[model samples]
Target: MQTLPVMHDADTEPLDDAVTRRVQARVGTVLRAKWRIDRVLGIGGMAAVYEGTHRNGKRGAIKMLHLELSVDPEARARFLREGYVANNVGHPGAVSVLDDDVAEDGSVFVVMELLEGKTVDALAEQRPTGRLGITEALRLADQLLDTLAAAHDKGIVHRDLKPENLFLTKDGALKVLDFGLARMREMQSNAKMTKTGNAMGTPAFMPPEQALGEWNRVDARSDLWAVGASLFTLMTGRLVHDAPTLNQLLLKAMTQAPAPIRTVLPGLPAEVAEVVDKSLAFDMNARFQDARGMQAGVRKAIAWLDKHGEPQNLVPVASLGTTSPGAVDSQMVTLKRDPTAPMAAPARPSRLAMIALSLGTLVLGGVVAFFVFGGSSGETPEPGPVASSSAGSARVGAPAPSATPSVAPIAPIEPARVAIEDAGAPPPVPSVTASAVKKGPSVKSGADFGEWGK
Candidate 1:
């Protein structure tokens, strides 16, 4: 028997080696009287994917469960379930599931659109220490969020989100692959798919809640955590959660806090780091409320960087809040005992916060003043006299509806006064009178004012 080509994941073990060779020897074998297998593409714990062709010259990838795994009813159910989920998603970002069926020997197989591009893992390998550039990372992240946002809208949660499951098309579009571990909100109660307390995913990228096997608690936000982890790995070339063993890995994911991106890549942009940090929040509520929210935030950050150049300094952790759109927090980073950093955040309120507070104070002060100085009193004050500047000083004493303020009315509007004008002059300029019965030039009983000494 020919040996099977090896392609294994550390966290998951493949079926028995004897069974693998028995399947690998079937290369060049035709199936369904219409599709022919070319060779083995790769092998996973449960299925072996192959490059295959239909008699009509159509090309695609075929996912077939090894004969050994096919015998088990549970494994067969999973193999067929993946095809159903991928097909139901019906989005361009998700790999298109075409056909699924059981061959003559009861070996199950699924046909999918053959993609020519590499997985994100392969792309990462070609980059600088597996870390992508800031702009590239943002660009890719935007696309991925859009994918998850679409899936989320369909009530599908991609529980297993990782670089291995994300395919970067040769044309530069991103395709989210692998739905074998996804859970449908509508299909949750189905016994064929529902299995609680048995979490199946790449542990490094799994969110804390999912890591703890809190299956029922998982939601769209759970996928968001993986999105964050993928981006973290994309830019830093390191897993946000890492360990030497599975138990320790799951433990760390559930109990440990991911190091801030700036801690690993100190030169990363603050806006970018902030968005990633929030997406990876230990509390689900602290994360972007949804995938679309995350998309907007990333775009907002990228727009900021485009308009105002990137800043190269770090700030205090407490100062950082969820940097969503319209929130007051944007300068957040993981605090690492660097309170003395030159560009540390201020302890006082933010500049925007201070401005808002001052405005609020002004408004409150105005309201108080209105009540104290402009509010109604127990008694009403009589209307003041209107002094007629044209009538000269004699008009002040004329109590017959003149423009001058009434002397008797001063008791109500206490300590208040008005100005009378010299209307006879070229221009009317009002002058304040100290005394209601004034001896000054402002008003008079029978004296000449602006006319000077006559």
Candidate 2:
């Protein structure tokens, strides 16, 4: 559970600096005789992350609670509970908590798997546009939704979800980090831990209910809102609500609707924009009812991307680390269309339409057969007219012959050709030339065509 760098208000700078100093001093020291602190990874308001090597030669990240918070029984318990809550998710996307122990100096620390990847926020910053491409953005969102779905199923709600809390590994796997602020639905007794009037989460990513300190109203839907806000930022390089002061930001979050996603990325697909809009709905009931529902919406957006082909601006997440900011990778530029352009309809007909055409062709052939064979009468109908010459040309304004004559059987109609014609495609031209028709057998009567159908 490594925390990323976050800006703090002027009033909290001194405290943050002091905490950082204290945590930095622990470098080169051995904790509990089983783990050795190698260096400080990151420091947050609540804890500091350190690279730790165990006596068994295995390495992991040690997240130690601040000394001041370690003394508070409630804070210590909540900090340790992050391990249990994360494991409860039972998802590979959730970072695994290996162990928990106390330092000699009375600081509590939990060990987590050491991950070799950049946080999503860092990855996005590497892009030239300060945002992710449509394909990569949706890929990360899909994985995030899967993890959230598992967490929600176990009665857990992640009170905080932001780009900084999501890490994309070198191998392209996205891991969810920091269950510190998560609310465990089964632990009703711990409801007192979060004070009724005190809001707890990043202001920019918080939903209206969470920002208003309406803890009773926070549920899986609250997490969905945060995911939407985070995705909005990831795709647009802007906050949902921006303000000069924390108070104003929180105020805006509670009262104002997030600007529609299309306003920032006007080229975005309507289906994708709609998903973000629905998730940000102020009314919880109007939002995706669960993580599964939101996941379904995300999958649909991915399907749209697949049909349209990858956008020209797409930058693969793998290249972001080595590629310099504002630099585009020639190998990764797979531009199929301008992302801002209107979505084009599929080039081919739908499967259902093709199937219907096939059935209609078969039904029509059956009716023609019934009339030609005299409808169960077991008798062949009389022939009408035929071309006497080998050229297969019909006579114009000619009197009907007193006696019918024999004719060559007609070629069978192809079902695929019929389906194409039914779908509004132009009919294919016959390849036979006049000379070829003349060399072929002549048509003596119309009844000869029915022999091919039989």
Candidate 3:
């Protein structure tokens, strides 16, 4: 018999040596006359995944139940049920199960969409401090909460949620893996997958109720606790309760209150600390009641980070409201303004208002000119306080006064003259003309015309 290496972690128990050999023997063999097992991916307590290729040249992952467990009807039923539960999650983050069939040897197998990515735990281990940067960590956490919100909405509680189960693809998308231990609310009364006193899930990520095996009390909030614990580990590089023995670790998770996130990373923003701390509260009621509520808390922390110059790189997995696009929270959209920057200029007046103002100014100037100089009588007035030659030359769209003295010179309006006088500057020249006023001045970009211009 050939021996195969079994991947073991804090979350998965190692299979017996005998069972390991039996699982490895399936390699190079075809199942359902289509998917041919190429190699073993990983072996766990209940199932082993194999990389398989179909006869049609398509590739997929084949998750096969352990030969030992397949003999038991209940175990086979539970193992096959994973496909149904995960598909019902109705989220893009959830891996899709393609097909399920029974092997010739009586073992059951299910093909799933093959994913290419490292688990969160593996990525964290690659980092120097075994901790992700604040922005990256929160971004992943936000995506995780979004997936959980979808699962919770379907009345499914993922009893087992840990760093190892979250896969971050090369394209920066997060996928939630492993729904084998999920508990459907509809099955709570009729079927008891786990006895009331038998503990389940990874001890490091399990909440008080799940660690103590209070199956009845475990609900959506229990999953939130696991999310908090997973984030605590990703940000701090340490578990909430670490011990030498599994029994000691489980004991601590059941009885001890998790240390505040700030205790581990003191420089963490208060908004982030509050969300993680509240999620890990010993009493489930103190934690976020639903996935949406917890998601909102995470968004607030992200918003706070944005204000503090800690922008995140990950794109949002979902819009503000999962169902309604218009229900976005104001805090998430609003950014803090820079106090040192100049105040924004007020809104500009409409084109119609600008035309009206220019027309009014032209009519008033024409009335003053008519009263100052000769009117419709067509007689030139005496040269009293004669306007400067420069003023007449600058008048736009108006003919210059005839050298024969038959035409009267136009003077600048009193208001225009007052404005120039207030500046204590040179003699002002008349610029506005009847034709020019009819065709208003062109508005140039960034040009400020004071209140009227705006």
Best by lDDT: 2
lDDT tens readout by residue for model 2, 114-230: 777566766787677888877688889899999999999999898878776777776888888778668787774554434344465666788888776667888999999989988
Model 1 C-alpha lDDT per residue in residues 1-454, reported as the tens digit of each score: 2233354433235446776676677688888887898766555545666678899998877878767667777677756767787777777887777778887777888888877656665567665455566667778889989888888888889887766567676689887776766787877886332344444455677787776666688899989988888888777666675455545556677777787877766667788989899999999999988999999988988897788766533232323221211121111011111223344333444566656656655655554355334546745434555454432222244333223222211122221111111224221001111101101111111100010000
| Candidate 3, 421-447: lDDT as tens digits | 112322111111000001111110000
What lDDT would candidate 2 get against the real structure?
0.66
lDDT of each: 0.62, 0.66, 0.65
lDDT value, residue 116 of candidate 2? 71
Model 3 clash tally? Answer: 2
Error of 1 at 77 (Å): 1.6
Residue 148 alpha-carbon offset, candidate 2, angstroms: 0.4
Give per-residue lDDT, candidate 2, residue 138.
82
**Angstrom error at residue 421, model 3:** 99
- Count of backbone clashes for each model? 7, 3, 2
Ranking by lDDT: 2, 3, 1
Q: Candidate 2, after superposition: displacement of residue 227 in Å?
A: 1.0
Q: Estimated TM-score per prediction? A: 0.65, 0.65, 0.64
